[model samples]
Target: MTAAIWTDGVPVQGLGLMRLTDDGWGDSDRDPATLVQVALDEGVTLLDTAEMYGNEDIVGRALGSHRDQITLCSKFGVYRGDSGRHDDWYVRADPATVRTAVDGSLGRLGVDHLDLYYLHHRSEETPIEETVEAMAELKQAGKIRALGLSNVTLEDIRRAHAVHPIAAVQEQWSLTQRGVEDYLPTLAELGIALVAHSPMGHGVLNQNADGELAHELSRIASELGVGAGQVALAWVHQCARQTQGTVIPLPGTSSVSHLRANVAASRIELGDVDIRRLTAAV
Candidate 1:
């Protein structure tokens, strides 16, 4: 039962809800309730979502009964009403807008308070201090348990944390995409956890099971009697351990089987030699 350390001292580790609903990327035939239930039963307690993903309502419906069992996390800042394209959403992190967004998210999710709320992206128009002050107000009012930032740089994190203590930061991190590694020292210094989205390399590592990096992962997985994806996730866990920061990889999947596999990856341990081989392969 390896766990990602949160600032609040609660255990959190598991899948994200990015693909739980149909968002024009692909059709999802999976029932939201079933998906959420299966994830919980498998010990994947951290469920991350965003208003921009167009699946907050579905997530709300699914977690209505099981809300107490999950560490629910959702993001604001992206205006989803203007266009259907995911990238077309506009940034709105002003104090007024942040208030409106959190209220809307609360209504959609049927939750009075969010376990963690995030500013989906940095808005150049709005200063981070103002936005975070507003978020700190929410915490004081008991609307959110913790503050989080997504798609933010180290500098942005410092600015925001100066206003309020940031509990977590979400970034796209994977074996092939290690840019987020640069911010680990800063994150550790601030005592903020790293929530890694796309921890599977966007399925590239799984797709290239016989390729170079994947080949090494497969070899290691075979020796450990685990799947290659599990090995990759273990590498991330190892990175977090080495950096003295918590790293929780949110690998989203609509399939129940895949969800179980991803959750089980949390328990895989990569030895020193396995880590060196995997690191060199990348």
Candidate 2:
């Protein structure tokens, strides 16, 4: 799939910025600017961030004059209290909330318009149609170029698509976390891209991976002379290839070495047997 088809011409392999924040992924102290530059240097230009990450300001600062070189993406509606605790999380997709959130995101990212904007999560109280309608209005006004949905149901995609074309759907999917696989068919049928967040299964498919999954990943990575994380990323790319759809794995890392490794994984092609073994092991 061509990048333009779904990612606004940015490469299908992306970088998730959640790890740059202090909330998770122990690399908060690493320079965010250095990581961003390394990612851009390696052609991994689809940088995904969210208001929830509390690092949009860091990402925005890192952008400098390179905004046009990458696909600036961020999410809204899924929020938490000022305490910044995950336990205080909530969702709000009211039209008013949608309008306010995008503006705030824009100011933080220092961008006039977002290349892709996502409703981080569907609000239980707000109708999907209403939220999408407000997002469509944003597109019409040029506040955002395309619309996306994250952590949404297949039904939500259908209803939202009825109101507007969903450019992509971001979901957590990996060898260890395959729940998002159930929606791949619908996503492919509609020509909407799948942005695989946490494509490493939140570290479960990396060095931290255990049990049979870890052993199998180690064997494959050893044979391929690559890291287990790269094998996992290759599997994600293979998934998109099998469906003939775009699957951009947005792996987050604050380390420059790991950033380059993740981008390099996009080029690693796993053989049919290796792919099968990895699948069965998971």
Candidate 3:
């Protein structure tokens, strides 16, 4: 899938709804319903959610009359483990589970189909090809428009892509976190887009925190006459441009002001020297 094919007119910045349901991140005063509308109004058409987020119903109600106006995305397979810790989540992508999960997601989201449906995590007990084959069946059944993979290895991508064309890969990538950079060449070669989740270091890069990258972002942001968060987004965009792949920074925010600011950040451009400086600082 080429950048144009995967993006398909979706903006370079998207809205992540994980934070909407997480009390640790979102504002207690902000309503998730209104945040969805604000995202559409800002042209952030890529609205991402997940079964794990536990807010599909809220997102569904919020989308309301404008569901057709955005590329609605969701994920499956990830389930709570015994410990129930964030890092202890488990995955199950058997053919039976895949069918049951999609139906449940559709019911919760109040939609007949999903624009993009991702296998949230690789299953240790199941083969990637089998999981993707099940997803392809869903696409054939008109349940999902495109297939995506998240938090998957490069080998997983190759094996899954062989079964079905992968439209995108969702992972964490930002100025402060660049592990996903290693996958850029392969993703570009495959023509699969990279949907960068937590592209702002999960809000650390935006705060006035004390750190080398923070200071550097502030310095470059001051020179560019924009906020540091915008600089971070610009770097992600420039990095994607260099790789010749579609990399949409999916940042989440319950605050309307923060959402608007992030949308505005999508347009900030950075020079080569500043890009290098920010790249090196990280």
Candidate 4:
């Protein structure tokens, strides 16, 4: 079994979550509450969601009576309105909005305190310091255990960390999308963990995958008797290990089989040769 690391005292390794209710991508017929329980039974303790996902209520219902067994993480600073345009939904992360957002998230998730709360994105209108200070106030008030930032640059991270210690940063990362790698060293220096979302390349690496990188991953998976998605996740995990920083990949799945396969990837230890192959493939 892969060893679990402590993120603000919460034990977690490979993270998992059900798709947001409004995303129109998840299985609408399958119950998310049951899926969350299945994940808990399989040892995937870090559950990630967002207010923008518009499924916090469903997550709350699913988390009922089992909140203590997992680390609940959700993001703020984004929402969807009637307009449907992306620009109309990016809310400013000012102090007042931060307070109101946390309250709404808590109410929706049916929890008194969140294991980790993230500022969904950097707001152009509000200073990062002010937003972080508001988060620190929430931490002081016992409303949140730790703070995180998502989809941010190194400068945003530096500014937020200066105001308050950031426990983790969530970003899109996978074998095909390695844009976040530039900030790994900075995250390591700051002693903050990296929560990687879309570890499977939005299912592109698993479907009609024919490029050199995909071919290499498939060969490795065949050799290991595992799915290609598992190999891709293992690559991300191995990169984090080599960099001396904690990386928890939140692979969202509605299928039980897929969830189990993802959890199993944690035990897939990539050797130096395998790492070299993946590095070259990327």
State in Å the error of residue 163, model 2: 0.6
Q: Estimate each model's TM-score.
A: 0.88, 0.92, 0.91, 0.89
Ranking by lDDT: 2, 3, 1, 4
Task: Report the C-alpha lDDT of model 2 over 1-282, residue by residue, as the tens digit.
Answer: 345433446376888888675333234446677777778778888888998887888789888888888888999998777787769888999999889999999999888999889999988999999999999999899999889999899999999999888999999988888898889889888988899998888876778887887988899899989999889988887776787566778888777888878877888899898889888987
lDDT of each: 0.81, 0.84, 0.84, 0.80
lDDT of 1 by residue, 1-282 (tens): 023323344444667887776432222446677778878777777888988877888788888689888888999997764567656667899999888888999998889989889999999899999999999899898888889999887899999999888989999877888999998889888888888888888777765755578779878888888788778877877776677777777887777777777777777877898888887788
Error of 3 at 138 (Å): 0.7
In angstroms, give how far residue 227 of model 1 lies from its true place.
3.0
> Which predicted model would earn the best TM-score?
2
Error of 3 at 136 (Å): 0.7
Report the candidate with higher TM-score, 1 versus 3: 3
Question: On residues 24-123, what C-alpha lDDT tens digit does candidate 3 reach at each position?
Answer: 2255346666777778777788899999888888788778788877789999999888896878877889999999999999999999999899999988
Candidate 3 segments exceeding 4 Å error: 1-8, 22-29, 208-210
Stronger candidate by TM-score (2 vs 3): 2
Question: Candidate 1 versus the native: TM-score?
Answer: 0.88
**TM-score-superior candidate, 1 or 4:** 4
- C-alpha lDDT of candidate 3 relative to the true structure: 0.84
Higher-scoring candidate on TM-score, 1 or 2: 2
